[model samples]
Target chain A: MHSWVDGQPVDSVPLKDRGLAYGDGLFETIAVKAGQPLLLDRHLQRLNEGCRRLALVADHGVIRSEVLAYAVALGDGILKLILTRGDSLRGYGLNPGAPVRRILQGSAPATYPPAHGVEGIRLFPCATRLAEQPLLAGLKHLNRLEQVLARAEWQDADHAEGLMLDMSGRVIEGVFSNLFLVRNGLLLTSDLSRCGVAGVMRAELLAQAQALGIPVVVADVSVEQLRQADEVFVCNSVYGIWPVRGCAAMSWPVGPLTRKLQGIVRALLDI
Target chain B: MHSWVDGQPVDSVPLKDRGLAYGDGLFETIAVKAGQPLLLDRHLQRLNEGCRRLALVADHGVIRSEVLAYAVALGDGILKLILTRGDSLRGYGLNPGAPVRRILQGSAPATYPPAHGVEGIRLFPCATRLAEQPLLAGLKHLNRLEQVLARAEWQDADHAEGLMLDMSGRVIEGVFSNLFLVRNGLLLTSDLSRCGVAGVMRAELLAQAQALGIPVVVADVSVEQLRQADEVFVCNSVYGIWPVRGCAAMSWPVGPLTRKLQGIVRALLDI
Candidate 1:
C-alpha cells in the first residue's frame, strides 16, 4: 500500500482538514490497469462537478496529472483520490483563500469470489433508507455515513451486496454500487437526482447500452418493479459489475442483458 | 493550539481513518472554563447516544477521563473531541473488531462581537435545506456538509448565523446553533427528530426552562411561525446564546425571556 497527500508521498492529513472535520470533500475510486486509469474522463467529470457544487476550489488539470503519475508508478491497482476544502479552524466558515488538499492512496487490486459474477449473488435487503437530498445527491461527496450504516446491516458471506431504498420506498442503489434492472427488454436505473452516488461505471454502461441500441430509462424504481424485472445487476468503477441473482424473497436469472453489459464492463476494466 | 490522537500528542490522523474516508464519527465541541469542561455530562450523553445509533463501539468512561485531562492542560479554551470508527481498507464494510479512534484538539476560546450577543444579530436565510434522515437526525455525528453549505451561503459579518430549514420547508436550526422563538411568553424550539444537530446548549436551556416554569414547545416550526414570533434567539455550547434580530423580511426585538435565558446560559458557561 502507498499514499500521497498534496502530491507528497505521505500517509496522513492535517488534523484540522475540513474533510475530517465535516466530510467537506469529494472522492473518486478509479481502477488502474497496466499503468492506465479506466474511465478516467467520467471519474474526473464527476469529481469536477462535485467540487463545483461544493464551492471547492481545485485545478482539474493538476489533479489529472497527479493521477496519471500515480497510476504509472503503481502499474495496476485501485487508486482512491480525495479532494478536500483544505484545513480550517474549528468552524463551518471557509477560508476563502485556502488551497484545496489532494490525497491519493493506492492498494493492490481487490479480489472477489469468481462465482459472484458468473452465478450472480444475493442482496441483504437493507432496512436503511437513503434520505432524499438533491443538494448533495450523486456527487460522491465524503458524507457517506448512510452507506456505512447500510453495509453494516449484514455481515454474512451469504449476501455479497445490499439493496437500498429511498425514504419514499423507491428502490435506489446498492450500498456501494449503482443498481440497474432490465424489464421488458428495457435497461432501467433509479434516478439519482434525489440520492445515491452517480457511479462512473453506471454512466459508462448506460452510454454503452445506447450505443448498442438498447433502450435505457433512468427513473424512479420501486422494489415491486425491481422484483418484476427480467434481470438485475449492480455496477461500480472498481468491481465492474456484479449480477444480482436475488434479494430476500425474490430471485432472477442472469439474463442476456446483464451478461452483455458485464462483458462490456469487463473489457473496459481489463479484468 | 494543541492536539492529541488516541491520548498521544499528534497533529494528524491516518489517511485511512473512516472519519476522513466517510465521516464515520461523532464529535463534541465543549467550552472549557477555568479548566472545567462545561456541560460535560450532556455532551457525553449525546456522544453515547450517537455511538449507539451509529453502531460505533467506544468506551465512554475512557473518553471522559481523556477529555478531563485534555481540558485541564488547556484551561479557558475550546475543546473538540472526535471519535471515529478507526481505520479500514477502501470499503464501507466495518472491521468488526477495529479499535475506535479518539482525537482531541484544543484552541483559544472563540471571540465574537459583543454587540451581536447583546443587541442581537441578523440572520441569513439560507437556501440549503437539510435532508430528513431520522436515523441520523439530532445526532451530532460528523456528516455535516449541510451545515458547511449553509454557512457558506453568507460570508458578510452583518448576519452572524444562517437559519436552516428541512427539505419540506420546516425551520430546523441555525447553521451552527439551535434556534428558539418565544411567542406569548411561551418558548418554542424546532423538533430535531427529522433533522438538525441537537446542541448541548439547546438541551440544557430546555431543561432550565422546564425548571424555571417557562413553557416550552418542541414541534415543527415553519418560517411563517418564526416570523410571527415575539422574539427569536440561537444557542450553542461554545457561545451560549445570541439573540436573532431578524431573518430575511422579518424582524423582532430582544424580549425579556431572551435576556433571562441568556443570563442563565452565561452563568452556566461562566463567560
Candidate 2:
C-alpha cells in the first residue's frame, strides 16, 4: 500500500496522535476510478461538517487537493483519508495549538465475489447494537468499535455483511454500509439522527432518488418493518450496492426498486 | 516522553493499525512511583477482561513484564499502555491471525493545582451525554471521543473536571474520572454496568471503604440525588482523588466520609 501523512510520503503516524490515543478523528473511504475519486464533493462536505462538529481544525482546500493528487497517482484503487485532532500528551484535553493530522492511504481496489451483486448476499444478524449518541452519530468518525465487534460476529463466507440495530432494537444499518428497504414503493432507511454513519453513497442515492421522483423516507425502522419490506439492499461508496436476499430467518427477493437503485448507483460510481 | 511499540523503542505506529483506524483496542493509564507501577494487578486484570470482551488475543504475562520493565526504567511518572488489534487493510473485520500490538509510553507525572485536592474543585456539567453500550461500557477502550468532547466543553481553569450523564439522564461519571457521592452517610457510585469507565482507583477505594466498615451503594444516580449529596468526589488512576465542591447550581461540603476515603486513597497511591 502507498500512503502519505500530512502531505508527506510516510507510512506511520506519531504515537501521541489523538487518532490513536482516543479515536479523535474522522475518516473517508473514497473509490478511485480512472485517476479520479468518485463522489469527491460528498466526501469533502462530510469531512468539513465532521471537523466543525468535533471542533477540529483542518484545511479542507488542502485536503481536497491532496486527495485529488493522491488519487491521480494511484490511477484505480481505494483511497482512505484520516483527519485526526493531532497529537496530545496523555490527556483528554485538547491542545488548542495542535495541528490537525491528515493521513492518506492508497490500496488496490477491493475485490469481492461478483455474485454478491449479480445474485444477492445474506446479512448476518449481529447481536451488538449501536449506542445512541446524536453528537457523534452520522459522521464517519474513528470511534467504531461497535461496527468492529459486529463484523467479527461472523467469519463464514456465506454472509457478505452484518445487520446492526440500535440499542433500542431499531434496525440501523449494515456493518460497513448504509441499509435501505422498499415498502410498497417508498425507499426507507433508518434515521441516523440518533446513531449510524451517514455514508456518502447514501447521501448521493437519496439525492438522485428524489431527483428521479422516487419517494424516500428516513425514519425509525423496526425489525418487523424490515421483515415486511418488498426488497432490501446495502450500499457504500466503494461497492456501490448489493441486494440483500435474506437476514437470518426472513428473506426478500431482489425487487425492481433494488435493481433500479443499484443501476443508478453503479452508473454514479462508474462501476 | 519515552515510548515503546511492541516492546521496541519506537515513537510511531503504522497507519493501518486498528487502534488508529477503528479504535479497536484498550488502554490503561497507570501511575508509577519509586520504580514501582502502582496497582499493577488491577490494571492487568482490567486489560485481560477487556481483551476477553473484545475477542482480541493478547498475552497478559508479557504485558505485565513489559510494564514492569518500562516503569523501572522511568522511575517515577505516568505510564500509558495501549493494546491495539494491530494493523489491517481498510476494513472492520478482524484479521484472525493478526498479532495484537502493545505500546508503552512514559511521561512526566501530571501536575495539577494543589487546591484541587485540598480546597476542592468545581465540576463542569457537560452537555455531551455518554451513550449506554453494555458491550463497551466499563472497559477503558480506545473509543473515547465522548470524553474528548466532554473535556472540550470547558476551557476555563475554574472547572477541574466535567460531569457526564448517560443518554437516559442518569449521572454517569467525570470526563476522565469515576464519581462517587456520600448521601445519608452511605457511599454511592453510579453503576458502570450500563456506561462509564470502571477506574482502578474507584475499584480500590470501594474495596478499602468496605474493609473500613463504610456502607457502599452502587446504583443509578440521578442529578437530583447528586444535588442532594452530602459530599462528592472524583477519582482516577493518575490523580488519587479530588474533592468536589460545586457543580453548576449544586454544592457539597467535603464530608468526613469523603476525607476518610481520600486519605486511604492518598496513602494507597503513596502520594
Candidate 3:
C-alpha cells in the first residue's frame, strides 16, 4: 500500500493517535479512476462537516491538495483518507492545540462479481441493531464497530451485504452502504438524524433524483415499507450502487429505477 | 513510551489494522505497582470475554504471560493493551483466519490533584448521550468517540469528568469511568446490558462491597435517583476512584461508603 501521514511518507501511524485510541477520527473512501478521484468535493465536504461536528480544526485546502496529489500518483485504485485529532496522553481529554493528523493510503480496487451489479445482490438482515445517536449520526467517523459486527453476521458468499436496522426496528442502511427504496416511483430513504451514515452517493442520488424529476422523501422507513417497495438498492461512493435481490424473505427485482441510477453512477465515476 | 505489536517492539501500528480502521478490538488499561500488575487476572478475563463476544480468536494465556512480563519490567506505571482483529482490506468484512494483533504499550502513571480523591471532583452533565448498544456495551472496545465528545464538553479545570446519560435519560457513567450512587446505604449502579463499560474497578468494588456486607444493586439509575442519593462516585481501573461532589444542580457529599471503598482500593493497589 502507498501511504502518507500529514503529507509525509510514513510506514505506520503512531500508536498513541487518538484515531487508534478512541476512534476519534473522520475517514473518506474515494474511488480513483485513471488518476482522478471521483466526487472529491463531496468527500471533502463531508469531512469538513465531520471536523466541524467533532470540533477539530482541519485544513481542508491542504487535505484537498494532498488527497488529489496522492490519488493522481496512484493512477487508479481506492484511496482512504483518515483525519484524526492527533496523538494524546492516556485519557479522553484532548491536548490543547493538538495537530490534526491526515493519513492517506491507496489500495487496488477490490474485484467483485459483475453479477452484483447486473443480477443484484442478496443481503442478510443483521441481528445487530444500530443504536440511535443523533449526535454522531451521518458522519463517517472511525467509531464503526457496529458496522463491523453487522457485517460479520453473514459469512456466505451468497449474501453480498447485511441490512442493518435501528433499535426502533426502522430500516437504516446496509452494513457499509446507504439504503434507498423506490416505492411508486418515489425515492425513499431513512432519516439519518437518529442513526446510520448518510453516504456521499446517497446524497448524490437524492440530488440527481430531484434533477430527474423523481420525487424523493427523506423520512423514517420501516422493514414492511421496504418489503412493499417496488425496487430496493444500496449505494456507496466506492462501489457505486447495487440493486437488492433479497433481504431475509423479501426479494426484490432489479427494477428500472435501480438500473437508471446505476447507469448514471457509472458515468459519474467514469468521468 | 514503550510499545510492542504481536510481542515484537514497534513504534507505530499499520494504518490498515482494524483497530484504527474500524475499532474492531478490545483494550485493557491496568495500573502497575512495584513490578506487579494490579488485577491482571480480571483484565485478561474481561479481554477473553470480549473476544468471545466479538467472535475473535484470542490466546488469553499468551496475552496473560506477556502482559505480566511487560508490566513487571516497567515496575510502576500505566499499561495499555490493545487486541485488534488485525490488518484487513478497506471494508467491514473480516479476513478469514487473520491473526489477531496484540499491542502492549506502557506509559508513566497520570498525576491528578490529591483533592480530587479527598474532596471529590465536579462533574459536567454532557449533552452527548450514550447510545444503547448491548452487543458493544460493557466491552472496552476501541469505539469510544462518544466518550471523547463527552470529555470535550468541559473546558474548565473544575470539571474533572463529565457525567453521561443514555438516550433514555437514565444516568449511565462518566465519560471514562463507571458511576455508582449510594442511596439508603445501598450501592446503586447502572446495568451494563444496555450500555456503559463494566470497568474492572467497578466489578472489584461490587465484590468488595458485598464482602463488606454493604447491599449492592445493579439496575437502572436515573438522574433524579442520583440527586436523591447520599453519595455518588465514579471508578475506573487506571485512576482507582473519584467521589462526585456536584453534577448540574444536584450536589453530593463524600460519604462514608465512598471513603471506605477508597481506602480499600488504595490498600489493594499499594500491596
Compute the lDDT of residue B12 as modeled in candidate 1. 98
Instruction: Per model, state how many residue pairs clash.
Output: 0, 0, 0
Clashing pairs in 2: none
Better of 1 and 3 by lDDT: 1
Instruction: Please identify which of the two predictions, 2 or 3, would achieve the higher lDDT against the true structure.
Output: 2
After superposition, candidate 1 runs with Cα above 4 Å error: none
Instruction: Provide the lDDT at A202 for model 2.
Output: 93
Per-residue CA lDDT of candidate 1, range B190-271, in tens? 9999889999999999999999999999999988899999999999999999999999999999999999999998889887
- lDDT for model 3, on a 0 to 1 scale? 0.90
In the range A229-256, model 1's lDDT, one tens digit per residue, is 9999998999889999999999999999
Q: Can you rank all candidates by DockQ, best first?
A: 2, 1, 3
Q: Rate the local accuracy (lDDT) of all candidates.
A: 0.93, 0.93, 0.90
lDDT per residue for candidate 3 within B1-271, as digits (tens), equals: 5698888889799888998898889999999998788988888888989999998898888898899899888888999999999998658888876889999999887687878888999899999999999998899999999998888888998899989999999999999889999999999999988888999998999999999999999999887898899999998887788999998888988999999999998888772
Q: Who is ahead in TM-score, 2 or 3?
A: 2
Q: Residue B124 in candidate 3 has what lDDT?
A: 92
Give all candidate RMSDs, comma-separated: 0.9, 0.9, 1.3
Question: Runs in model 2 with CA error above 4 Å?
Answer: none
Cα distance off (Å), candidate 3, residue A144: 0.8
